[model samples]
Target: MKRSFSILSLLTQGTGLLALALALGGNPPARADENLFGFVRGAETLPKGHYDVYQTVTLRTGKDVGVYRGWDSDTEVEYGFTDKLQGSLSLVNRYIYNRGVEELDDTNHLTFGGFEGTTKYRILSPFKDPFGLAVRLETGWLLHDEVAGLLEHEIYVAPEIIVQKNFLDDTLITELNFGGEWAWGKDPAEQYYKEFSLQGGVGVTYRIAPKWFVGLEGHARGEWPLFNFNLFEHSVVYAGPAIHYATERWWVTLSYNYQIYGHGIDELPRTQTFAEETRHEIRFKVGFNF
Candidate 1:
């Protein structure tokens, strides 16, 4: 476990150093307003011909039978294919550790989560229209062994629509997002199941300085069993505060979200305990733009 933590720390530090080096190495294009919220994506796309690279680390913990902890690291490269379109590719790594429960104590595992790709298209720009409008599609394929007994072999699709409105001379911004995800896979018992989830969120941010912003966001999510089509499996809601800092070449964001409520299907047998829901989540992201 210590070795795994060291490796993850080294990877994060190395990526940060590489991003800094790139930011300082050459004369890149002028930086635009960054998509600052780490947890809730905004409706804005990168400028045409520009690129952004980011690294994000997330931590989640819960108290079920005992204590369950999960960590995820995602590295992404995003590019603007046109003024109204953008694409991104990401690599994900995940780790889980559980303690205190006799049947699950000292069970810690680290593995590759998956590879994800995303495309976003802007239909309307707030600068030119009354409100910003956009849509995004994301897909991922799991590539590693299941972590802590939770299944990882699945393919998932997510689609979302984004809406944004700016106020106070563009210093205050608000965004809304609606989305759904579907995942299909077979369990270790060879039982096939499809997981369907609906998600939505709203975020409000205000620029506090030339390069700093503060915000809050609220999110709600619900899961369902697909075979029955109408059976609700679980639901969770989260709210948090977020902060962002940016420069001409680099940017960073940090946020904390606590699950305010949860219901149904939060527990499982000892063998599948890792799939349990968490109480809170924390995220940190850093990016370099060029």
Candidate 2:
């Protein structure tokens, strides 16, 4: 009877160990959700001691009436402090060419855009849990306004929440992101201004081949020029397609987002885009892991 009891206890212990092993080893494919989309992010962070370098370029064009072109470039280095947390710092630069835009003065030059830092923490892994979740925070100081293509001094803080889900054995992935930004700045006239914006985006990707994915993304944004909620300035919506290719050590992605809807108090007749924003945006991104 004692032998029978001992055998039962050993079997129970063996089963428990097996289950623990399965749980610990069931992580998603390497960096599965790490930047599969251009704008909407996923909830996977690098493993401890891993690092990556990224370069991104964005172009904004067509401000309704006059010739307006803006280019933004960013370089970032990211490092994983732990499996759950990662951090990055980015250097930004911008170039703007403006002609007869009523709201903007004529200018054609490249200027420093800003410097920013970001932190992200993952709470769950879609492969292991029901879904993936993460929180992110970004802080920046501006030398060139992003939308207006003008010289300004500004400080901004942005916070975001990201969620991701996978289907069909990771062949398809979906992500949703929600974020808000608060900014304080001084215009060229030396007057102070406070601004706030709300943003949301959704992306869906399907893996057609190994290390290749094609996706579509949609984004919406609304802004309040001052602290008052009644002063709603403008709202715009963008939707486009993205393509990405990845190897073990490197990846590249490109996307084009076009404004499909716009409305504002100070917008053009019939076409309601704000002077600060444009009708089209294109972005290209590349990353290397080490």
Candidate 3:
């Protein structure tokens, strides 16, 4: 069965709000320190005594035939606890649709993906230091069955280091992120497993106009086997372009990524020689700062 709601539908619904914001704007302010795109985190924290609220939507399609399609929406709230520290909370929802599953007649499911919390601290300021440096800790719980028909009861912890540099009067920006996730979970069949993954990303953006920025981002991820931690089960790389638009009160970003390379079990085993991996992804985010 086909679902009536989709990522496109969600974006369409928000068009009116975006138009309204555009109508009420002045020249966009200086760009924030956040990365323009990709999964990378930038080494900037919110200004003290400020709040940011945002929503993000992501769509992913499998590289292999007869795999799965996934859509996710996340709502997040963040507060600047101090000049050097920030905290955030997020709620996630997901939808998954399976293909080529002969055993199940109904191949689509929508469910709550669960919640996440994050804390970040800046160790060095780009304004004074050579580069911006920060560390972030994130944890999340997933108690839903929307992913691959798996009732995943998982707990995951991720730690990330963010580095940033700017040049030419802060018009040209660069960001780097290194992170890893450790997860333990029960699968759909009640099989318990532990997994570890490593990820890194780099992004560069140039402020072309006061309110507009364009950038390119690249990301790489590798999955390690549980028992034999030294061996990677698969690896993939993605690269794409991103655009950002911001006004004094609100901002929006859009990015698209396509897998450039894959190794080991990257596609589904039966469908291709590799395990299933994301072939393409699109992300959209809109936020307000107060």
Q: Tell me which of candidates 2 and 3 scores higher on lDDT.
A: 2
**lDDT per model vs. reference:** 0.79, 0.85, 0.77
lDDT of candidate 1? 0.79
TM-score per candidate, chains pooled:
0.81, 0.86, 0.81
Whichever of 1 and 3 has more lDDT, that candidate is 1
lDDT of 2 by residue, 99-121 (tens): 88876778888888989999999
lDDT string, candidate 3, 1-290, tens digits: 13556766778879977887877883464333443664556788888888789899988876454666778889999888888899999998988887774333346888888899999999998777889999999999887643454568878899999899988887888889999988778465233376788888999999999988899988888877563566667777888988988887788889888888877643334322124357787889888887
lDDT of 3 at 49: 80
Most accurate candidate by TM-score: 2
Q: Candidate 3 regions off by >4 Å?
A: 1-35, 101-106, 145-149, 189-192, 266-274
TM-score of 3: 0.81
Flag clash pairs in model 3.
Answer: 265-275, 266-275, 267-274, 267-275, 267-276, 268-275
Worst 10 residues of 2 by lDDT: 26-35
